[model samples]
Target chain A: MKTEEMITRLAEGLRPVRRMPSPPVMLALWTLLAASVIGLAALVFGTREGLDRPMTRFDMMHSLAALLTALLAGLAAFELALPDRDRRWAWLPLPAIGLWLGTMGVGCVGELVRLGAEGIRFHVSWPCLQFIIGLGLPMAGLMLWLTRHAAWIRPGPVAGFGALSAAAFASIGLTLVHPTFGPLMVLAWHGVAVLAVTGLAALFGPRLAWRVPA
Target chain B: MSHAQPLCLMLAPGQVARDARDLRWSTLMAAAQEGDGAAYATLLAECLPFLRAICRARLRDAAEAEDAVQDALLTLHRVRHTYDPARPFRPWVAAIAERRALDRLRRRGRQVARETLLDDAAELGAEGEAEERLAACQLREAVGELPQAQRTALQLTKIEQLSLQEASARSGMSIGALKVATHRALHSLRRRLTGGAP
Candidate 1:
């Protein structure tokens, strides 16, 4: 069909639809959902046995960093979903991601320095990975569904950040339930799950979600 | 990959054109959002040339380019509510166009692959049947090009492989007339194939 004819048909069929909420509003909604999921997971799984341990500066820093990372990543994902919006918005989460990595690095180094080679023992928990992924699945699916109408210019970055946002929020829940393991172990397993989710989303998100008219 | 650069540095003269177009579209879109049909029609009408240009640039085939433009327009209509007046309109439109073009390309690729597989499968079957199939196609074309009476007679008797009496009954023609029509069609086909006058 001719372009003019198609355009005419489209205009004739136009029906007013409510505009999507702004990125900030969507991010807020996502955050609320993430918090609810984390809260529910914590309640169901139970908090770690050391509920009474005095919160350390490191612990506070880590929690803050995780929260910031999730919030920033969520915001970036929402912004990236819009096509004509500035691509620079993709960088919004960088600082928070850096802080997250820095906190993990500092925690691992501090652990290594205090506990010499003999005191530090490396361990991997299969259930930790399972819990993180299991909780992350719904959050990831929700993020994808929310952004389905978005015209993704850089689908890879958008999907990567989206996966990161979901995984980070799920990690928060995992931390509350799982017993304290070595900092390095936490970093390794959590980091692996984050990377895996991000990699998978980047690879297949465009094919699955970024469909246009045939 | 090059180090990430600011989107401002990446802006080109084309973006300036986009800015102007987007400004106009945003106004029209805002009006359309408020139930202004004329404004909406004008917006879509104005978008046609731009959509055509983008589709042509992205797609090599002219027909495919036109189809992609239509697809993009339909998609734009479906997602019109997603448009934010604050954002530039061209990139939003371009993103949809590029996506549609890419989808067409991907689908075309898959279709070609499937056809290739089917051709290979056909080749693996009775090799002698290939020549027979080609001859059958040519004969069908030749018979179709004949006059109506001759075509009907040839189709009934030759292609359908029916007996003269059955073909006569089906076509409401006498056996002698059907025979004469079929004979004339074959003679005409032979002359055409042999590069002789009918």
Candidate 2:
């Protein structure tokens, strides 16, 4: 049809659409939902044994970093979801990720320094994998649903940060209940789960996210 | 790639006036979000030239550019709820226009890759007069099956080579109606001939 006629038809069909929440508001809502879901997971799984034990300095640092990572990654995902947003904003979570990884790396070194090779004991942690996935799936679903419109323009980045946010938040919950066993164990199983989740989400995100209008 | 700049920058004559216009668009869009059809219509009508300029810039083919503009308009309508009144309207519309134009270019690229144009000499020398006649017969039948208004619009505009204004006057339809009818007729014919490719 002629452009003018198309415009007229569009105008004829005009109806008030509820505006999407601002990015910060969406992030807040997502955080609330994510917290509820993760709390439910923690409750179902039960907090780790020795829940009464005080956290070490390293443990507190690691947890704090994980929290920051989740929040920053979530913010980045929301920002990237805006069509006019600069893609460079995808790096907003980089520092948080670096800090989280850095703390984990330090913990690993400390464990090795204290216990030598024995501290690096590695075994498949099925429970850890299950917990991460269980906590992550719902959060990822929420992220994808929230940012589905933006996915049409920047699917990979949006999905990557979204998955990272979910995975990082899941890690925080996993840490609360799952025994560190050793820093290496946490890195081996928990880290792998996070990577696996992010990789899988980014890979399939376009299909799982909303398709562009035909 | 060079044409990938923001449409407002490329089309707007002066920054100050453009900013004022942008503010007006945002206000109209806000009103549109509240279901004011007049505001929505004015906003869209004002945006047409800018959208056209951007699409035409991205797509060298005039027909393709027009199609892209329509696609962008449809997309804008669908995603109207996503707009924030706090943000400038130009970028939102520009981004959609650019994306639609790029989509058209990509589709054209894929088509070009898959198709090889036949030489005029080869087509003329082919021994396929019977097949051509059959195709023409099928096309005529498809045209005949169109709604009366569309058939007349198509015949006046495409077959009889009349301008849209001439066709509108002849058919006793408004220019907009004539254009819509002709577009529908062509789209219908394409679908029938291409088995729903259109």
Candidate 3:
């Protein structure tokens, strides 16, 4: 082909793809997500072991678990709806950070309410590890997931930025539980998770092409 | 290879005679990369006639001639990143342009097959005779520059030998809507030829 004509065709011939999902679909997804969180919260709050005994500390710990579960479920479902973006951003840090923050906030609040007169005590024991798993994991996972090894958004970079963004958001939740865990642990965990999530996001986020025309 | 050659194997008499600007391989590439519209215009203007001749000699339709060139250009821009800075540009561009033109021809044939299936109509597969093909090229030489879409629709369906359905699919035109594209190509071809012949 003539180079000029060929060039002209390229400039002139291209057409935009237009098959993006509608707003109603987005609203529906959001609504379903909200309902799931509420339902799980109710389920956690409603179950009182022997009807009046008010349940043990271990059993009453369902509130944090339920919140984490709801966040996970909602993110997983929404990830599936994003086309071409596919499975890339679906995994790791995004929902994990949010869930972790939520878990910490709810768990600390519930613990305080339960042990009113005595208040809650901190120990670096196995349950302390449980505290980490329920609260710490989300923040840590989110941070690591967001930041890449090099921490840049250059093309072909594999780190997902959204995960980092999630971690940053989740920090608020983590700080809420700081009274039970000290400033040192909160700062440490929050620091690691935020850096990780942000780095990953910088590396991988731009590849999403969220608004590709068909 | 250290040297670059125009590999079309079929250049016509006046095809190279007209639209002769920035004919040297390096100059055109530099112009194109630098976003000089005039240089681009010259580069395309020089190449269109020969490319059209190839389309005409093969396809037997004025419309397809323009499309072959248009598609080739679009392919050129899309894959521009692949061009080697150290090499002569013509050969690289020619290879892409030729492949794109052939692809358009094939896609056009596919579309015709599909449209025929839908209507239970016999598809127009241009059969026999050298004169018809040459005439088609002559017609294309005159009026190949209209809208890119129209050029593409015509080239794929006619010269490249795609059926309407297949052409429609690649072009993102519905089977029902392709007739408009066909009309536009032919009408422009007629107007250009009446005023002056290429």
Candidate 4:
């Protein structure tokens, strides 16, 4: 079509669009939704037994890091969705990710010190995969819905952040309920889940997120 | 700091005019988001010169530059909601135009490469043609793997250089089906060759 005709057609078809919320607002919205969904799922499934056991410092640190990573990654996704935003904003989640990894590393070393080679024993936990990914489905879906319109330019990275956020949030809820495993098991299974979710979302999100001109 | 403040105050005439234009465009865009057709039309019309300049600067071919401008306009229309009223508009539009121009450039470059390589292959005839031959072999292998319908459509339309009507009659598929099959075949070939990188 001629440019003039396209412009006229576009103008004729114009309709009021709901402005996307700012990144911080979107982050808050995702956080609330994620918390509610994950928390409800945990409540429904019931938390890990040992409710009276004292929480360790590592447990607290790990939870905080996951939460921070989710929030930062969510924010990055929203920020990167806009066409005018700097691409460097993609680095927003890096520090939190580093912290999360560091906490796992520290926990692994602490386990090794306390229990020798037995601490790092690898165990295949089917429930870990099921809970993380299964619970993560809704969170990822919600994120994709929220960013559907905004992610025209950077859909892959945005969806990646969305998946990361969802997976991390799912991990947090899973930790509260699922029986604690060895640090190595947590690292292996949980890391795999996160990678799988991120990779899949990144692979398919562009196709799902936007309708580009032919 | 005081000295620099005075220097900063002395804005150039061109900068002042550009800033004013940006503010006007932003206001129009904000209005356009509210479904103001006149505002949207005027905004797009006003943006033509700048978009043309950007496209022309980046794309040497007139037709391609024009196409890029149209693409930019379409993109701007599609993502109008992404424009925050608080931000300046020029950067947003410029970014879209620049991205579209670069896309056109990349596409043009790829087309040139393919055409040149094909021409080189034909010219080489009996001489060393290892690289082009390998590429052709890979493409042929990929095409061989396509589904029967898509392969027939591609062969009839692309390899045989038949018109869609002729290809449709020969393949016993409607024109629309042929078009879709041919498109999918090309897409599949591209994905196979590029390893699914978009």
TM of each candidate vs. truth: 0.69, 0.77, 0.29, 0.77
Model 2, range B74-141, lDDT digits (tens) per residue? Answer: 66876787789899888888888888899889989977865544334346756675577689899989
Output the number of the DockQ-best candidate.
2
Superposition TM-score, candidate 2 onto the true structure: 0.77
Q: Per-residue lDDT of B99-135 in model 3, one digit per residue for the tens?
A: 5556566777998988666444323444433455566
Model 1 accuracy (lDDT, Cα): 0.76
Candidate 3 deviant stretches above 4 angstroms:
A1-214, B1-23, B115-198
TM-score of 1: 0.69
What tens digits encode model 2's per-residue C-alpha lDDT throughout A35-67? 898788778878888768898887788888888
Of 1 and 3, the candidate ranking higher by DockQ: 1
Assign candidate 4 its CAPRI class.
acceptable
Score chain B of candidate 4 by TM-score: 0.60
lDDT at residue B33 of model 1 (Cα atoms) = 73
Give the deviation of candidate 2 from the true structure as CA RMSD. Answer: 8.2
Q: For candidate 4, what is the TM-score? A: 0.77
Q: What lDDT does each candidate get? A: 0.76, 0.81, 0.46, 0.82
lDDT of 3: 0.46
> What is the alpha-carbon RMSD of candidate 3 to the true structure?
18.6
Residue-wise lDDT of candidate 4 within B131-172, one digit each (tens)?
A: 667888999999999999999899989986766854653555
Look at candidate 1 and tell me the lDDT of residue A48.
89
Model 2: CA > 4 A from native: A211-214, B1-13, B116-198
